[model samples]
Target: MDMERRTLLGLAAGAGMALSVTGARAQTIADGGRAGPADPTEIIRLWPDGTPGGEGVTVTPIVPERSTDPAFHDRYAQYTTDPILTVFRPERPNGSAMLLIPGGGYRWAVLDKEGYDVARVFAASGTTCFVLRYRLPADGWAAGADAPLQDAQRAIRLIRSRAADYGVDPKKIGVLGASAGGHLAGLASARTDAAYAATDAADALSLRPDLTVLMYPVATMADPYVHAGSRTHLLGETPSPERIAAYSLERMDWRGAAPVFLLHALDDASVPVENSLQLLTTLKAAAVPTEVHLFQEGSHGFGIRLIQGRPAQVWPDLVRAWAARLDFPL
Candidate 1:
């Protein structure tokens, strides 16, 4: 193996061993009942000097809100005052990477299903994955709707800055997000400038993702199809028209935005499939390379599990093929 690949694999192995010693449990898969790869190589805080607008904020232990449901226990994770990026390195280094952002309506982050489970799938396919546990806007942790976007931008920049250490090509880095996390990813893709003022050297790097994948995302803050909970959580109960327009992904400038792959189920009532469709239209109009799949019955939040046995479960393969088409080294 090349030295770069060897260094990454060695780091991955060490991370697994360290997780074992630290008593961090492996994430459980959705359908197969298998476990996720060992805990991440490292959990780097998004802001080591304390997050902006996070003064006097205290962290509470993450408690599964729907503890009675096995699915919830398997998928949900909450209460994150200190946002971080959990690095999951692949055994086979492909010089590509993705930063995953989980969704909980901007109220909490779904660390297991949308984060770890998805990470395992991509990592297994040779892409190093970093699962971002971003700060929630509902927690009043940051100033405005830009808090999540700030974290997303920082995560991308940090990954790019440390790409060599992780055997990743900075140019091949992408961002994937689900639900509200998808909104954050889309926003980050369109707005690459640092949302918050530069606090350190990492901020000097570009936040633009090379590509983007958004699954069942809340694409717009407008009504008729808006996920009310997500909109309210991210922008407060009474968001101004200007704020709503600014956060709407469809309205953002698409200049220099990365190629995108979007997947959503038409029957999704929670987020509405129109979210993806609207964004697809905008992307197409802007002449951005974009591909979209609207499933007939996969509902919502299906992560990497099989949904109705066929097309839904095949999204990962589609994503792989898409990445290959883009020559992303995956």
Candidate 2:
């Protein structure tokens, strides 16, 4: 009868389709088909062997709430392939690996423009690239606080576990995120909070990234400046004050954080530049290895697109140079 109900009903219907049901009337029925190994709690197979048999890499559809929420499925349907990673070690290869997290306000992952495109550049620069299709927020289930972080941590550990196979230097793994993904990246680099039980062998590997790259990140949990959507989606309607403190990267100690590179636009509108400024200041004050690039003019969520008159487009090159300075094989 009302907007909320309508939205909920629509979401339910979408969820049904995601679960292989035809319409809104029928309940979800398991096909008893086993999908490949992923986070059994989060990801679902939309097109198990890539999309309709077009193979570049195996891509999976990731849902927010145990892979059952229709609203999340509907939003995820808009994204075809997020291309988790691309390795470009042809000859004289290096062992560095990087995970790229795309930004879409925690609603959807902007996989193509941000994830794959950026990965291509980094891969050219001798770093193995992983374009992540991380779980989105807004449907509870540790959304704002832990879900994305878990995805990143798992990805890092997974890469580390397969380092020899992928020809990656296990100790040189890095993470880069854009917009809300940048927030996730920062949290991944900052928080030592463990999400999964240390049952498996991969659990022994640390999730802390060696280096972090933030492109217009939503860096805080405090009000006014914090992206309310990300906060509400992550913490839910009634998050405790302690949870807020826990998620704020600026408030946390920078000693344990990895080397961080922050790129932001001074004239952006959606997310203020102060987010970068505050985090950079804190990193500097704490003597954390940090680099900040404040572009003259560029809006939020630009996703590697070049502006007509601004030097913001040169970020990839700058980032490549920075990566070169890390002393890993290039």
Candidate 1 lDDT over 18-88, as tens digits, reads: 11111122322223222334455456667777678876456553534343443433545554555678788
Return the top candidate by lDDT.
Answer: 1
lDDT of 2 by residue, 1-330 (tens): 123433443464344422211112212333223232111112222222222212332333443222343222111222223223323343344778888887777767765456656765666656777767655444333233465666677778877877897788888888899888898888888878676555457769998888899999988878768877767766777778898888777888878688888999988787888889888888998887887888888888776544534688888777767767877433
User: Model 1: residues >4 Å from true position, as ranges?
Assistant: 1-37, 56-61, 65-75, 306-308
lDDT of 1 at 94: 94
Q: Give each model's whole-structure lDDT.
A: 0.79, 0.64
Whole-model lDDT, candidate 2? 0.64
**C-alpha lDDT (0 to 100) for residue 238 of candidate 2:** 70
Model 2 stretches with alpha carbons more than 4 Å out = 1-92, 140-144, 306-309
Query: Could you say which candidate leads in TM-score?
Result: 1
